[model samples]
Target: PRLLRAAGVAQVVPPLAARDGRLHVPLCRQAGGLQLAVFAYITGRGGADAPLGREQWRQFGATLRAVHQTPVPEPLRRALPTWQEPGEVGRWLQRALPVWRRQKGRTAAARALIEVIGVRYDELQALTARMLALHQRLGERIAAGELRCALCHSDAHVHNLMVDQQERVWLIDWDGASWSPIERDLMFVIGGLSADLLRPHETEWFFEGYGPVQIDWPALATCRYAWAVTDVHAFAIEALGERDEARASSSAAWFERLFAPGEIVALAREGEAWL
Candidate 1:
């Protein structure tokens, strides 16, 4: 939050420090074993349900560009992690495929996901293989110093954006911040991952605020494919590996949506042509 504020981002909810002057505090293990933290609440309205107007979308684009362009000081840069190959999907495929093949689901949602997997298993396998291959190639390029890296708000979806009372757009959710290809964020905006948020024609307004950008298609394709694979792994875990009925039901719905006609899986497949 301080980094973005220093960069002159329109707005950011600064994190409040704890008694020790640390912004993040640890929670009890029973409470999920995650860190606890709080931020200065912004008086704004924003969420997945609150669709942005074209101008607001443009502002969001500019805000993201500012984040990407912010320089990381040497000490902080050394501490921040660079993007790594996504592994959850491969792990899920290894562990879950056998159970799915046997149709040994423990819950209704699990059964539904298993049934869908039974029908589309080969397609899923092929896509995972392709995504892994793309990531390998990108890694080679990065090693050869052919790709540029930048600070990224890696999960800059509509749900993480806010529109303040002053009409300025604020970016929230810095937990996923990392050093990555700029395409890591751009994939959501101009690269079809955000079809639910901005139509293709309306993306021009975003560019209007962002100015001209030279897109690296291969990098964008990798990001899109990785996103689909990661999302599938996440929802599958909830649907098949958890006992919460309501959460499982929601996960099952989201898992099905990933393969819907115009959804993330399809978008990732469409991106394969860019490679």
Candidate 2:
């Protein structure tokens, strides 16, 4: 809350489900709305794929840049868990594997999932083991000059954003927020934005608006596909009546996408770049 003032937001109001990755608040007049900045919900079914206005998305990205630029207050930093630590990522992946395994036998599609994911239980176990190993390896790289990091709105897509009647886009969920390769945010929003909501040319313009930064679509494509797997995991878990478990496992799949190279290369070539 205190950290937000540093970010220029007036306040961080409490919501009924704040801990559950959502915020529902009556809009303050300055919020420029009818009195709510609720967590976005996909209207009419396809869930996260639902419509998010184009102007709203562009504004959302801009808002995120501002939010990311905000400094963390000492007290708030003390009060909150430090996200993006290697230990945290490792813990998250470990915790999520069990959840994924639990659903293994339950989902009729579990077998199909195993095939699509290119892993069996043992395989996933080994892969996750390797992921932890690589986590250690990447930690070394990140600590050295090899990698650059930035705070990211892990769920950078438009669905997690809401624009009031004023058209001021507000970012909602922070469940997956972390410090990662700066490209995580770019690849995420770019890859996941739907055909109806986004087009490649528009996305190019969007990235151009990010000011000055490299836009390697192939690399971004890598991150995007990894995110896609997680998206599928999220949808399936929510459908399976296990929302919390879903979020964790699905998010793991997302991380796995980053670590797993074959998937990334394939996604880049596949033009996971949809409209």
- Using TM-score as the measure, which candidate wins? 1
What does candidate 2's lDDT look like per residue over 1-275, in tens digits?
Answer: 22444467531222335555454554676766654434335233221444555565555556556555666555644544332353444446456655655555334344344344445445444534543454455556667867665556666665665545564555666756665665667765564434444556556555543555655454354345444434444543443443354454554455345434444323433553431
Q: Against the correct fold, how does model 2 do in TM-score?
A: 0.53
Please report, as a residue range, the 10-residue window in candidate 1 with the lowest summed lDDT. 85-94
lDDT assessment of candidate 1:
0.80
Candidate 1 on 1-275: residue-level lDDT in tens?
A: 77778778755677888998998887987888799888877787974657677888788778888888888898887777666736445556656665665766778878878888888788878877787888888888888999999998888877888888877778899887878899998887765664676577557767777778898899999988888888877788778886777788899899889988778998998987899
How far out, in Å, is residue 134 in model 1? Answer: 0.3
TM-score of each: 0.91, 0.53
lDDT, candidates in the order shown: 0.80, 0.49
